[model samples]
Target: MSSQKEKTSPFMAKAIEAALSAKSITSPNPWVGALLEHQGQIINVSSTKKYGAAHAEAQTLQGKHLPEGTLYTTLEPCVAFEGKRTEPCTQIIIKSGIKKVVIGIEDPDPRVKGRGIIQLREAGIEVQIGDGADEITRLLRPYIKHRQTGLPYVIAKFAASIDGKIATKTGASQWITGEKARDTAHHQRAWVDGILIGSGTAISDDPSLTARPKNLSPEQFTQPLRIVLDGSGKLPVNSKILQPTGTIIATSPKSEKNWQDSLTEQGAQIIICEPSQNGSGINLEQLLQVLGSRSILSLWVEGGSQILGSFFSQNLIDELWAFIAPIIIGGDGLSAISTTGTSTLAEVPHLREIVIEKLEQDFLIRGFTGNWAP
Candidate 1:
């Protein structure tokens, strides 16, 4: 039984894996549940549901005799009480005769930041942390981000034709990629905390912004933050996006009224960009910095041609996921990007590296920076 498990404190690792599976349980509070075992015997198990629900530690201590100095749990013990309950998780662990604590992911909420570990250490509890919690932690990031940033991971999404046109000559471009590619796009949304698009695209297309093809589980799509980039501030106040999860307006500093407080009142976050070039949209680098400072660890730039081109020219892309539609449109409309300025393969910014994956039709090209264009 001992050799059957794998990777760092097998009991804790397995418990973390089990706890991480609750990523979809967002509504009714984050359900952080775990099981404890020592010397191949089930000692106890527990979970946290809603605010007043029995704490994971409380349930863990249910009807059991624990061995002294035995390690317990992957979630930090709670200290702060919400509503009418005041049972701190620290006191419970100490009372249970459990001499050690093992946490999976650090509590991301700043209010309770580091308090769990501090209390456990002060009480002379031997603390051990699980190693493989990152994967599960990342999966739970969607829920954590909502509590902290008031906004989700703002990923920009777009699809362009061979020549970079989002639409054709008459401007009627519906389905450009195959079913497989389109399906993949929706799945990609699961990784992002939110979806962002320009007001122009929103007004022009009126996309629902929900994960498409309907592959995601119900819990996955229910909480993504939706954003709209409207530099001129032309979006309707009662827009559809504003009705549901509401819309985050990416406005410039010029729109002083378009700051965070106002947007927050309207269930939105006002993102201030660094002004658009030629009085158009804001610079992508500055835009990303603003989002990154807000703790948007990862982002996806949905393209419309000019937007993708700007990032390409500036070489700000850390990773790229390009979907080549099976069929190519030889049109005089828009191109993926105009590739402005003068340059050949030699003149453009040289990519240090790239990995190419051949899909059913198009190629998925991922590129890296800092290298010369040789």
Candidate 2:
């Protein structure tokens, strides 16, 4: 169905591809470019490809002759920018004398949530917002979410063998996936705002918890916030995750004051929140809401199976990034995800099958997590 639509609407496909490529562009600006079409021909195309660079409208309008009234563009023009370089795009669209506005998707940034459409419509521009444009426009979700909510999109990473073991009987699980998968996982961290883990795993395994991208220089790693979901507040004093980046300890009131005080003295920020009934400490759901407040766009929960299982039980996980290792662990160990009670897919959230990328000796399977809506 999508193929047929793309076949008929070449402009949408090309614009979507451009938007996809623009995701890597840095800055306060979400990567956006404009393509001017006249009689089905893209006469001029401009993108905000670089930071402090020309914007989509500026690039498209640069000295290039424009046909009097060709359809404006496929991408919804960005109306407002808080950055120093530019003015609102709504004025540009208005000045363009464009009689029609065709927007792929509405902006998700809370600031401009629907203001672009409103501005265009107020100017009497014919606005068409959804013409097979959702998937393309959603590429801007992370950026808009970051701007509006001040946090990156949180995606939890997990791994397991065919038998659902994150590690072997000894829990000496290393290289569950090959270099390719591991590299991809690190890359995912680069895209996200931060990474999250449980204090239990932090104390038990003492993992570095920095989901670094491939080949990053030691200085470039700029590890994201290391979050430990320790309700009882029992993270080891010398756990290594606290040594490097900013460490946030989400604990409950029950956590020994001395333990929290010790963490505070060790250069850790302590957030004392209510614990859920399971008593994992710090309300996991509220913790995410707080991270959103702190501009931790995406939270990567990389932990032992039990930690992930708890998030699943708490219904806090939004997405799953799984690196399925080629090797098999036959021994009894933790499953990649352990639900709280005896539950099936039926009892819990609805999960959507997304895509799988084969990397090294493992398969990186990513999926959208939600309750079975159907």
Best model number under lDDT: 2
Candidate 1 on 104-181: residue-level lDDT in tens?
A: 656665556578878888888887664445533544544454445543333334455544465666545567766676
Predicted structure with the largest TM-score when compared to the true one: 2
Error of 1 at 106 (Å): 4.7
TM-score of 1: 0.62
lDDT tens per residue, model 2, 38-68: 7667776555665565667666666655535
- Work out the TM-score per prediction: 0.62, 0.78
RMSD of each: 7.3, 4.5
Q: What lDDT does each candidate get?
A: 0.58, 0.67
Scored by lDDT, model 1 comes in at 0.58
lDDT of 1 at 323: 64
